[model samples]
Target: MINDDLTHTPSTDQTTPAVATPDDRRPLGSTGLLASPVTVGTSGLGTPASADGSPAAGSTAFATAALRGPNLLVDTSNAYSDGRSETAIGDAIRQGGLPEGRGVVTKADQDPSTAVFDRDRVLRSFEESLERLGVERIPVFHLHDPYSVSFEDASAPGGAIEGMLALKEQGLVDAIGIAAGAISVMLPYVRTGVFDVLLTHNRFTLVDRSATGLLEEARSRGMGVFNAAPFGGGLLAGRRGRDGKPATYAYQAGSPELLAWVDRADELATRHGIPLAAAALAFSTRSELVDSTVVGMNRPERLEQVEALRTTLIPDDFWSDLEALGTPPSTITD
Candidate 1:
């Protein structure tokens, strides 16, 4: 279940990659890539503003800030908002060029309408993503959401796996990996020992830890792990969402019990003079299993806020107190 409150201890193994720091880049497994402790996620930037087909307001501005900010990586997918997310990143690059040594990681997705995940479609998807992003090559590419096809089919000779590997063989993408929501599905891909990176979101945050086993497994195989949504979709980050209807987790309504846990955690954090989000974010960044933590910064104004929170120093006693409260029960399993 996603609501697992399993605690983690940092790895003792010397070969484990360096933990990402606020001011420096950390290695992404052995892919010869490096990224900041925090990576800007762009799923929200591609939201359709209206029936008129205009991009959301402030999307480009936010992208520009992220591109020029301290972050060394920006993560997106071809399936996000039917490819508008890449367009927004591209526009941001054109408006204010990507900073030196920073990288953009994208994924190859199946055809939306037909659900075709073959080599031909993968090739087409990569080309289209490059065109939309106005880039000739990508640093890391993934086979996203392979549930459309069984593991057997995806690993077939002419399947999407071949397509992603071909991209790496051709030097079009520096690294290749799997990005998916289901832990069961992702575990299989990670066990194959072919992927260089692994991206899992909404499962490694403070209130939930369904991705615990997955992260450990991936790291043991020498794969970089990106843990997204350290805020648990904003509940663990704050008491109430912008809607003021209580915070939500995993895209569903936060249960009263879950809200109560947040309330208790909030008081605990306040008593220690720290915002709750700091603890939430630190949970991911401090984990030995995680190489990078991906957070959503969809607006220009949020860049500074996230940066501040990313660097906040919470007392160790506060973590002890927060842990004493225990995690909320799973009401919305991923």
Candidate 2:
């Protein structure tokens, strides 16, 4: 069942992505890929639920928000609800008044076990994504999930990387990238200077900072970095449902350490006059490591929450408090 609190809460005010100052508008990472500061992650696009995995009251309303926003970089993958999400996004773009030519930045799934690298399969998927979105080409086409990407898998007769390179060669994808979960895997890609962008999650959120090193490296290398999952899977949102469950779905909140961290986060939020999740996004984006922070929203109301970061800045004191409290209760090591 959908959580009551999540479904009913009023949309809160949010911080908009910083307008690109001359310095801010520069290329993402070292790859020379320019983008807006706030990108829309389409995890919740066609889903019955939000990105945190909660059902939304209106799917049509949710999709419209994703397509009509400012300087949005919309992300999608074939694997999201078996293309329902992509189709919904396409519908939104076609129906909503988002600009064309420079419309959305989306991702393509390259699960080679499915023989995705086969030229026919690759073309089919790309075309399918286009058919779903009603776009000619994706501005940014990322090879979703790099940590699991193998050189063997990428170079094999029908591998993910090869398929992506093919798309790039065909001018279907304006830029090539990888969406990664691990710093270890992303580092090499950033260092190689091959791919143009990196979509990273969990590694650079409120609960963890391991992506700090990689973010720095990517910046130095001139590759764009998109930070995903800033709320640690909604734990920081401070939203809960009836029956005392969280407003979103996640692996069960861990042990005493996690619970204790939640307590500390509550204390911290009270001090900051904001919720822990807002603080999390503020912390994640304040870093030089991030070019854009991709947030999933199920409604325009949800965008209000994401927009709240416009004024949030982590003071030195906030960092000091976190250090004193010990490693945060949440972390994304993988």
Candidate 3:
């Protein structure tokens, strides 16, 4: 069952100071847009119960705090809770009186059930997102989950990519990007050189580096690389469900091997007196290839903790040990 309080609570506190200053903002490639090294992920801020169906009493508070910070980038989607995510963000921006420098990155090209990737559908989706976000323009708009549509269909005449380009031409969007779980599907779009950014999740975390090559390719092309889900879903965050098992990868149940990997990571974290989630966050953001690390937070406190983790100094030996435990060699620097 979905938690009632998580979906509709807008009265959460907003007194917390912004996490970072203007100097903390990082350039998002050559787009001339600057983003916080840590971007707030609002997928969970939408109305659906989180994977564990827990109440997210802190979502509004988190959003308000994040918007007030120096690096103001919130990643949301039209499909998230049927646009609740965008609405919530819009509401927060108004309530918090966030400045104009704050930027929003929303997505289009959802699956067929939610949206199609044709020119008309893409245009309609962007319009809806603009209304939901209460903004005349978006800094970054991505073609979300392109793996759901054939590459041929998406790149052909009257395709979604073409529609996005049109919006850029008209100044509706500052930059365009492709975000997806499947590297194979997103890489083709990156190679097109039409996109200014790329967002890859799950495949580039502490326990997984399958997207390392993809990151390298994006970097070589001077595309901004946004790394999402640095905690491997909720596993590296050390969140366990009522079932007593760790939250699975991408919200599904974990395989035995995956669970075992988490077990070892947890043990190592405990030995060092560090939160496993902190280690995971630090590991994901350490790479120079990553222009920004996006983490999903539904609570104000969790957002604060993440901000702390970004600048937290983990001992070098801890990183060496963590790397020894099986992070992909390709992703290791020094």
Residue range 105-145, candidate 3, lDDT tens digits: 99985544754668777788899888877789889999888
TM-score of each: 0.89, 0.80, 0.86
CA displacement after TM-score superposition, residue 231 of candidate 2 (Å): 0.1
Residue 128 deviation, candidate 2, in Å? 1.4
Q: Model 2, residue 216: displacement in angstroms?
A: 3.1
> TM-score: which is higher, 2 or 3?
3
**C-alpha RMSD (angstroms) for model 2:** 5.7
Worst 10 residues of 1 by lDDT: 1-10
Give me the runs in candidate 3 sitting further than 4 Å from their true place.
1-11, 14-23, 48-62, 111-115, 244-246, 327-334
Per-candidate local distance difference test = 0.78, 0.62, 0.74
Candidate 1 local Cα displacement, residue 301, angstroms: 1.7
lDDT (Cα, tens digit) per residue for candidate 2, span 46-90: 555557653233554555664555545666676565666676666
Error of 3 at 55 (Å): 13
Model 3: how far is 183 from its true place, Å?
1.0
lDDT of 3 at 140: 94
Q: Identify the runs in model 1 with alpha carbons over 4 angstroms from their true place.
A: 1-22, 50-54, 239-246, 332-334
> Which digits, one per residue and each the tens of the lDDT, describe model 1 over residues 144-193?
88878999998889988899889999999999989887888898899989
From the highest TM-score down, the ranking of the candidates is 1, 3, 2
